[model samples]
Target: MQFIINGETVEVAADIRTSLLDLLRNYLGFTGTKKGCDQGACGACTVLVDGERINSCLALAVQYQHRNITTVEGLARNGSLHPLQQAFIDHDGFQCGYCTPGQLCSAIGMASEIERNIPSVVTKDLSATSVMLDETEFRERMSGNLCRCGAYNGIVEAISEATVPAAAAKTAGRASP
Candidate 1:
């Protein structure tokens, strides 16, 4: 099967039944996306499938053929860390760092959702094109990814900080010179 993983095109032979998580860690050797639970309950196996966060443990590798996959490894560009990665570091978003990769990927997808004005359960006005992401919105949206070390405070803080710049960039088009 062929896959575009982290901006690289690679082909590998694997069982059709193989889950994406297994294909990535076992076959392709990208171990950043953790395997907390084989089931989809835990978000440790989360990866962005065509820019949307999905639990890799629950998705078959064959199902993602020809689609873009963004693992934690792809977040950085030109040797510079993604804003969320830097925010995570600045806010101490991880304790053991096991869940950090999934958290970061999820945050990336979440930021995109916000930028597109997607509504969440906490969104007050559905008619509004853009919903401001406050603390409640962040917590509710991020409730899926679990952190056993209880780094919720830092995680929220980091995502909040990262989203501000993202929102600004979305509205302003580009950084001011």
Candidate 2:
């Protein structure tokens, strides 16, 4: 089967029942997306499927044929770290780093959702035309990804710094100048 991963098209022969995570890590050698739990309960296997985040453990390889698959390795561009990645470093968003890959991907996808004004569970005004990236929204949107090192504060701060505008972040005290 053919898969488009990290802006490259590659073909691999695999079993029909292979999970996307298995296909990525085992077959294609994209080991950045870790396998913390085989089940989707843990967000360690998150990846961007056509710019949207999905739990790769629960997805089948065949189901993503011809679609854009972006792993943590693909987040950088022109040899520069992605903004969120840099933010992660600046804010110490990770410790053991096992969940950093998934957190990065999920945060980027969540930023896109916010750009489109998509409402989350804590969205008080669905008709407000714009969703604020406040604490409630951040917590609710990022609840799925877990960090065993107890780095939730840094993760939230990093995401807020990267996704929220500088002025807004300053107003909310989410990021440094």
Candidate 3:
């Protein structure tokens, strides 16, 4: 299969049944995308495909031949960490850190999703003048991710208050870590 991963085009030998998580960790040595439960039950395998989040453990690598795949490693550019990564760190969004990568990718995508006016099922007014981020939306959209360390307060705060937005950034900054 041919796909662009982390901005590089690479050809990988994969069958239709090989999950993207396996191809990344076992075949391509990209272990950042975790294999929690291997059943898509957890969001540990979250990765960005065409700028949208996906659970790679449930997706076949061959199915992504035409997709732009971004693992946790791709979140950074040149040498600096992505703003989301830094935000996660500054907000103490993780504990054990096993789920940090997935949480980061999912948070980045979640922010973009909200910015694009994508309405979550919890949205009370789908046609509201503006889409607002709320706890219900966050919970519904990110329900797949499970943090055993129970750092959800920080995790949600970091994502909800990404530094790019001054208002939200202030929220996270003023929030207790």
* Number of the top-ranking candidate, with lDDT as the measure: 2
By lDDT, is 2 or 3 better?
Answer: 2
The TM-score, computed over Cα atoms with residue i paired to residue i, of candidate 2 is 0.91
Question: Please, what are the lDDT tens digits per residue for candidate 1 over residues 1-177?
Answer: 999999889999999999999999999999999999889886998899889999999999999988899999999999999988999999999999998999998888887887888888888779976766665677777888999999988888797788656753544332221
- Model 2 C-alpha lDDT per residue in residues 1-177, reported as the tens digit of each score: 999999999999999899999999999999999999889877999999998999999999999999999999999999999999999999999999999999999988887787777889998878876776677777888888989999988998898788666324323333231
TM-score, model 1 to reference:
0.90
User: Can you tell me which runs of candidate 2 are displaced by over 4 Å?
Assistant: 166-177
Could you arrange the candidates by TM-score from highest to lowest? 2, 1, 3
Best by TM-score: 2
Q: Superpose all Cα atoms of candidate 1 onto the true structure and report the RMSD in Å to 1 decimal.
A: 4.0
Q: What's the TM-score of each model vs. the native?
A: 0.90, 0.91, 0.88
Residue 31 displacement (Å), model 2: 0.4
Quantify all predictions' global Cα lDDT against the true fold: 0.85, 0.87, 0.80
